[model samples]
Target: MMDVGRHPNIKLLAYSEIESISGYIGNFHVRVRKKARYVDETQCTACGECAKVCPVAVPDEYQLGLSLRKAIYIPFAQAVPSAYLIDMKACLGTNPIACGKCAEKCDKKCINYDMQDEIIEFDAGVVIVATGMDVYDPTELEEYGYTRYENVITSMEFERLISAGGPSDGHFIRPSDKRRPKTVGFIQCVGSRSERRGKPYCSNICCMNTVKDTLLLKDHYPDVEAKVFYIDIRAFGKGFEDLFKRSKEAGVQYIRGIPGEIIEDPVTKNLKVMVEDTTTNRISEHELDMIVLSVGVTPRADMPEVQQLLTLSKTPDGFFMEAHPKLKPVDAPTSGVFFAGCAEAPKDVKDSVTQASAAASRAMTVLSAGKIKLEAITSVINPEICRFCTICAQACPYKAIKVEPKKKSIELIEAMCKGCGTCGAECRFGAIKMRHFTDEQTYAQIDAYLEEDPYNKIIVFACNWCSYAGADTCGGARLQYPPSARLIRTMCSGRVDEDWVLYAFRKGAPIVVVSGCHFVDCHYIDANRWTQKRVEKLWDKLEKLGIRPDRLFLEWISAAEGQRFAKTMIDIERHRQRVTKEEIEYTMKVLSEQK
Candidate 1:
């Protein structure tokens, strides 16, 4: 961090926020709002003269409120630029007449009460999101006694209490009395792996973090007793298992059970925990001087803003979704954006560092190439026929389409397009045509598939990423359902044009199924959502035309689900068998008339 701050080429914009983001890959225009620090960073030295005179004391958030800092202070010990910043909210100089002791005391005269926020604009080729994560606060968990008892603090507070620069000056102590505790209790997964109270995902670092803390305690004070309460210990990382073993060997007791409740003695300020040992099937109470709630990591508070600005997708856990879990773990579905650290998922320190390096390399490669490569599977807008209604623009998941209503113009950014063909499918008029998976090619595939005994065949429009791959997986697994199903592949389910479905039905097909990735897990971001809308519209149209809506089946199938693909095919076959030849002919005639 210090090296980056001093680097000639790197301009470190600390205490700044992204106000707005525009443009696309290799040509991005970004506006940043740099918050006022009230101190000239270039002139002010790291001397503690100004902080010593400031009267107002604020809770140090970096120390998890275990210590107090002056209103004018550096964020942390090794803060980049090594300058003190006045918190406007807490600083008395905000109302200049009240007080300005920091400005008066500064030997360099760098403090300025009239400092205003500055907005800066710049261009960048690629952006990497490494906003990191926030730790879950355990104050709501009354059973843990985090708020009621002073000694029942969080693991972060414990870290501050044990640190050399902490309030206790490297002496571990209870918050109530400021005296070192003989017995300490560590509770793992305080805000994780709980469907009711907290997040259902494992925190990924809590178990190992607790082990390290216990090891630290034993190394400093061997006589101090440390007991860890956890459902299970995950020591899967390199050298992590050895550290867990060392902690156990150092007399740290590991109990395979989550403590149900903590009761603190009002007079002594000691805590009593109730937990059931799953190994022995016994319930017992343990006494401790202090209890540390090992809180889980959660998505940053500003995650929503980041998601909106970057057009990024999020996972079920609320972290930014990667393009692919295995193949492109660090890359965002948005072409030029990448993710690092816990912004993508709850990763450990080493994993975060590794991802950061990979993101840098990816960004360098994109910049070095000077231009982004456009895939062949992008949508092309026919200006002559385009009504410029902006439906295509609205439906585009990547925001690749730009529509000008006044000028009656629509533009497509080829570099930004992910080839989902959502815009083409959403176009009411035949203005936007998807390359590779054109209307003509898709119609031909559907027509040919239903040419011979169409009533017996269930035509399936499967997405290339998920449903189509699922069929291949089914075949590889030797899973048999029925050969009556004929699959037609599109880049995305969103690429399945309504005309293609109408054409299939008019060709005398009994059942037509459209399948793709699940709504939230669309490989092309929200392309599958457009697919759902298109299918619903088709269903309504079919019903209005006196055709059975049930004849059109909509299913979401992932690539790994071979069994599900086979089951879905079997279900379609069963539905097809129920549709009599007379009903098929009637539906075919109705669709033909509608077309």
Candidate 2:
């Protein structure tokens, strides 16, 4: 932390929060709130004088409330900047002449009760999000008796109690009696893999952390008994299994089952644990001096704020969703933004460092050239055809389009545009044109395909990233599909303009299938979502125009689902067979009349 503070290129804004974020990848505008610390960071030498004179005291959050600290105190011992920050909530305002003892005693005269929060605005080429994580609170479990019992504590509190700099001064003692615990019981997966109470996902660090804690116990107090109860140990990391073995060799009893109930003695405060030892195949009870709940980590409570600010997506586990799970692990769907540390998932120290370095490297690669190279496949707008309704801008997934109200024009940043063609698809006026995949080119393909056996053929629009690749996978595997299926490849499902689908129907097509990547796995952020919306509107249009809505099909196919692709094509062939020549003619007549 000290080294980072002194680094030449690193400007450490120690106590700052991101207030707002705007603009796209290369030119991002950021507003940060540098919270008032009261003491000037450059002037204060982190002397203990201010803390000594301060009357207001509060529980130190760093120690998990195991110790008390004055209102005017450093956040932690190894905190960067090494400056004291006054808690405005705890410190009575000096304007009303409340407690002003700390301000007077400050030899550096850096105390300023009137200090206000400063908003700093800056532009950056890239940004990294390492918002970190929060630990699960086991108090709500109630059965663990966390708040109900004095001897029961979470794993974090246990760390502080065992630390040399802790309030207990390196004495590992029970909270109830303040005596060294002879027998300690560690409960694993306290707030993880529980469908009813907590998150159902496995916390990556819990099992290994418990093992290390047990090793620490045996090292410090050789005679101290340490018992761990868990479903199973996960030591998949390099040398992690060896550490688990060492802990077991040091006499850490690893049980197979979790405790069903923990009952504390009313007088001694020793916990009575009732658990089924799977290995022994018998229910047993054990008395322990202290109970430690090996708590799990969770996404930060303020994660939704970051998600909203960046317009980023999240996975089922609530972590920030990467661009691609396997290919672009550290990259955000919103380009230029990268995730590191616990912000992505519950990772250990080593894994977090690895991801942080990777994110930094990715950011550096983007800014190294000083100029962004845009893709040839981008959207173009016709000023003459544009009605300035702003529908295209509203439908754009990337927010790449800029609409000028006074100028009555739309400006698109080519570098920012991902070439998804969602804006073009949503433009009712036909003002926008996707550069390479223009309306004329797509229409020409549809016309040529429908020119021969339009009634017997099935028209399929596939996204390049997934569905198109799935079709190629079918070909590579020699999987059988209907010979009548004519595929139209687009950059994204969003590129399948409604005009093409209608034109195919107007030419007497039997079946039109719109297939793309699964809703969550779109290559162009949320471009597939625009595809979904457009398909729904087209379905309504078809239904109102006396055409069967079922004739317009929507499917989400991934690159790995080649078998499903072939099967879907067969099903489309079967559906096509059901449509008679008369029905096709009627559909074509209805669509042509509507057009």
For all predictions, the C-alpha RMSD in Å is 1.2, 2.0
- What are the per-residue Cα lDDT tens digits for candidate 2 across 1-595? 8889999998889899999999988889999999999989899998879999888889998888988989999988999999999998888758675778988899889999888999999998898999998999988898888889999898899999999988788989988888999999999999999899978889899989888899999999999999999999999999999999999999999988899878999999899998998999988888999989999989999999999788787777777888888888999888789999988889999999999999999999998977777878999988888888888888777778888757997888786788999999988898899998999998999899989778888899999999999999999999999899999999999999998899999998989999999977788867888888889999999889878888889999999889999999998788888888887889888877777
Tens-place lDDT digits, model 1, residues 3-84: 9998998999999999989888988889999999999999999798999989999999888777899999999999998999
- TM-score for each of the candidates: 0.98, 0.95
Model 2 clash pairs?
none
lDDT of each: 0.91, 0.89
lDDT for 403 (candidate 1): 93
Name the candidate that leads on TM-score.
1
Best by lDDT: 1
By summed lDDT, the worst window of 10 consecutive residues in model 1 runs over 92-101
What TM-score number comes out for model 1? Answer: 0.98
Among all windows of 10 consecutive residues in model 2, the one with the lowest summed lDDT is 90-99
Instruction: Check candidate 1 and list the clashing pairs.
Output: none
